[model samples]
Target: MEQLFFILLALLTLSAALMVVTTRNLLHAAFWLILVFFGIAGFFILLHAEFLAVVQVLIYIGAISTLIIFAIMLTRRIMDPQQPRFNSQWGLVGGLAALLFVVLAAVTTRVAWPTTSATLPAEPIKQLGADFVGVYAVPFEVASVLLVVAMIGAIIIARERG
Candidate 1:
């Protein structure tokens, strides 16, 4: 059952990721990206990381996707259907992507990996809260500020569009 679920989730995630890159429609691509994020959250849930799963949904699907949607809405004029999706940089971009893929694959194959199962803390939620407030406080606050900035920027752009 778990294997089947994982395979299905992997397929869905890959399909959504491919759609995100291939779809010319910005809105459609954003929606597909949401699906990809959802699949990532599902993976976290499957790995028994409930805390991570909730954060993934809340941060990625709720916040980031919302931001992307807002940006899409604000930039309505640039989404011209008649515009060419692939520009003259297509060959260079494709070569760079291929090169990156090769490098990543080589690194992956060269690395010695451990196959041990993850052991979660007794109180994961509490530990997570403690970490956020104690160790990761600065980074967390920085992310919050970044989100606020992005929201403000989006609003500013949208207002200018009107």
Candidate 2:
């Protein structure tokens, strides 16, 4: 069952990523990116990282995706057809990317991961909260501050001149 889920999640992630890269419309690409993020969050859940899954959904899907879509909608000339469809160097980039992917896959297959006897624990959310508040408190606070600043910047950018 877990293997089946992993396969499905992998397919979902890959398909969404392909959609994001191949879609001509910027708005459709953003939506596909959201699906990619959602599939990644599902993978995190499968790995017993509930906190990561929730944070991925909350931060990427909730905040970032909303901001991207809102920005797209706020554009005055959204349907302009003058935008170039593809970069001239796309073929070269795609070839290099394929080569790099092959090399990485070979290296990944060669790696032997460390084995652990510890069983998966319950109440992952509680454990994650404790760790975040205790050990990761500083970084968490910094991220919150950064997000606030970004929000303020976005508001300033969108403000109308009076």
Candidate 3:
């Protein structure tokens, strides 16, 4: 059952990712990307990383996807169906992307991944919460501040355009 679920989730993620790249409409692509993010969160849940799954949903699917959609919405020209979807350098970029994919695939296939039989922590969420507040507090706070600043900048830019 778990394996079947994993396969279905993988398929969904892959299809959504393909749609994100192939869709000409910016809004449609953003929606597909959100689906891809959801699929990642589902994978995290399958791995028993509940906190990671929640964070994935909240950060990627919620915040980042919303930001992307808003940007797409604010840019009226980008949503124009008559606009040229591909640029002159698209072929070059596509070739480079294919080469990168090939290189990554070769490297990943050659690497012998280690299998760990160790059990997970009994109270991983508690430990993670403690670490966030105790050790990683500063970095975590900094990231939050950075995100806030980015959001503010985006809003200001959008307002200026309007």
Candidate 4:
């Protein structure tokens, strides 16, 4: 059952990711990227990392995807659908990509993966919550403030020239 879900999720994620790259419409590609982000959150759920799943959905799906879509929408004139998708150097790029893939595959296969048989913490969520609120509270709040400032800056920048 788990394997089936993993396979299906992998296929969905990969397909969406491929669509993100292959789609001629930039907006459509952004939507596909959202699907890809959701698929990643699904993977975190399947791994029993509930907090990670929620964060993935919140940070990637909610924040990043929204930002990307907003950026795409803001530059409306730039995403001309009739424009040619591929550049003249596409063939050279493809050859380099293929070579990189082969090298990465060979390196990965040759590496020795270390496996751990250790058990997970019984109340990991509670521990995480305590750690966050206790030790990481200040940093977390700082990050939130920075993100809010960045978002406001983006909004101002994205506003149409009057």
Per-residue lDDT, model 4, residue 64, is: 85
With candidate 2 superimposed using the best TM-score fit, by how many Å does residue 162's alpha carbon deviate from the native? 3.7
- In TM-score terms, which candidate is top? 3
TM-score of each: 0.80, 0.83, 0.85, 0.80
TM-score order, best first, reads 3, 2, 4, 1
Could you say which candidate leads in lDDT? 3
Candidate 3 Cα errors over 4 Å, as ranges = 151-162
lDDT of 2 by residue, 34-143 (tens): 99999999989888788899999999999989988888777837535577657999999999999999999999888997889999877867877898899999999999
Candidate 4 per-residue C-alpha lDDT over 118-139 given as tens digits, one digit per residue, 9 for 90 to 100: 8888998999989888999999
* Cα error, candidate 2, residue 52 (Å): 2.7
Better of 3 and 4 by TM-score: 3
lDDT of 1 by residue, 16-119 (tens): 99899878888999999999999999999998898789999998989889989988888897688777778889889989998999999999999998877867
| Pick by TM-score: 2 or 4, better one | 2
Candidate 1 vs 3: which has more TM-score: 3
Counted clashes in each candidate structure: 0, 0, 0, 0
Off by over 4 Å in 2: 76-82
Candidate 1 stretches with Cα past 4 Å from truth are: 114-118, 141-162
